[model samples]
Target: MIGVMREGGLLVLTLQRPDKANALSKAMLSDLLAALDDPPQVLILTGEGRVFSAGADLEEAKAGLATDPIWDQLSNRIATLPSLTIAALNGTLAGGAMGMALACDLRLAVPGAKFFYPVMRLGYLPQPADPARLVALIGPARAKLILMAGAKIEAEEALAWGLIDRIVVPEDLLTTARALGADVLAAIPGHASAIKRLIG
Candidate 1:
């Protein structure tokens, strides 16, 4: 379930199924994909509970969800967005979920959040774009540490490694994300987006 909240020009997309560790079901993935089609100037992607996402829903994963092409499609769309996208990692980020976060413009995670993409251990490969993105934010060696070696990174280490931009307190996660997007929201219609394009 995806909970979309619009605040002025900012839209906060929350993964609403906490009972399942906010796992991404096929329906939830479809909802998220739909939500991104009309993104605001600043989009904040976060989760409702203590876990941003435990990756694909286990049941769905067993049924071939893990290798779905939609995963590649979703991550690619996020990467090409004109808006300033922020991933507000509310908690642990694992498995396939890393793709979306890796594609974001910036990542802010709570202090206790953990980051890992266990594709190696899971006996599956990450989406093609995902590995390239992961290497871009961090480095190829560090990317290998997680994707190849299955390393579980804590928020602090992730931040230091450039895997995440900031380590915010849980209570201030959304507020901080909103604040980070303030300038973008206030800028001329395409000013921020133009700057983002230049940076890329």
Candidate 2:
């Protein structure tokens, strides 16, 4: 499920499914789409507990891939969203979950959070849009290393590769993320939007 909260001009969306490692489900994807369509000035995405997301639920992915194009469309929307999108990676992120994090304009991960793209291991190809986004974040070489090897990179490695913007202690994750949001909110709304558009 999605939990939405407003802090000034920022909108914080938390993935609330620790029991399932915050795996993406059809309903959760739907909610995300709706949220992006009407996003706040700055959107902060994080998960409930120890895991940011474990990616698409295998069972759900199997069924949905046959009947829907939610994942593809969601990726497209996320890539083109006008707001300042930030992924507050609280814990481990894998597979399609990595796609979701990559979709964000900025990532602030907990110190020990692990990032992985494991689509190959699951007998599926990475999402078509992922290569470009991953390359944009960390360059072609590192992206290739991640996708080809399905390697899990911890926050420190991710920071060195420019895969994440910041890394903080787990206990400070939310506080740091909120402070970042506050910094964004401090700017005039119109200026913030203009800057986001210019940067994009």
Compare the candidates by TM-score and give the number of the best one: 1
Task: Please provide, for model 2 over 36-64, each residue's C-alpha lDDT reduced to its tens digit, 9 standing for 90 to 100.
Answer: 76767778889998999988876888886
- For model 1, give the 10-residue run with minimal summed lDDT: 30-39
TM-score of 1: 0.98
Cα-based lDDT for every prediction: 0.92, 0.81
* Stretches of candidate 1 exceeding 4 Å from the true structure: none
Model 1: per-residue Cα lDDT over 1-200, one tens digit each = 78989878898999999999999998988888898888689989999989999999999999999989988888888888889999999999999999999989999999889998999988999988898999888899999999999999999999899999999999999999999999999998998889999999
> What TM-score do all the candidates reach, one by one?
0.98, 0.91
RMSD values, in order shown? 0.8, 1.9
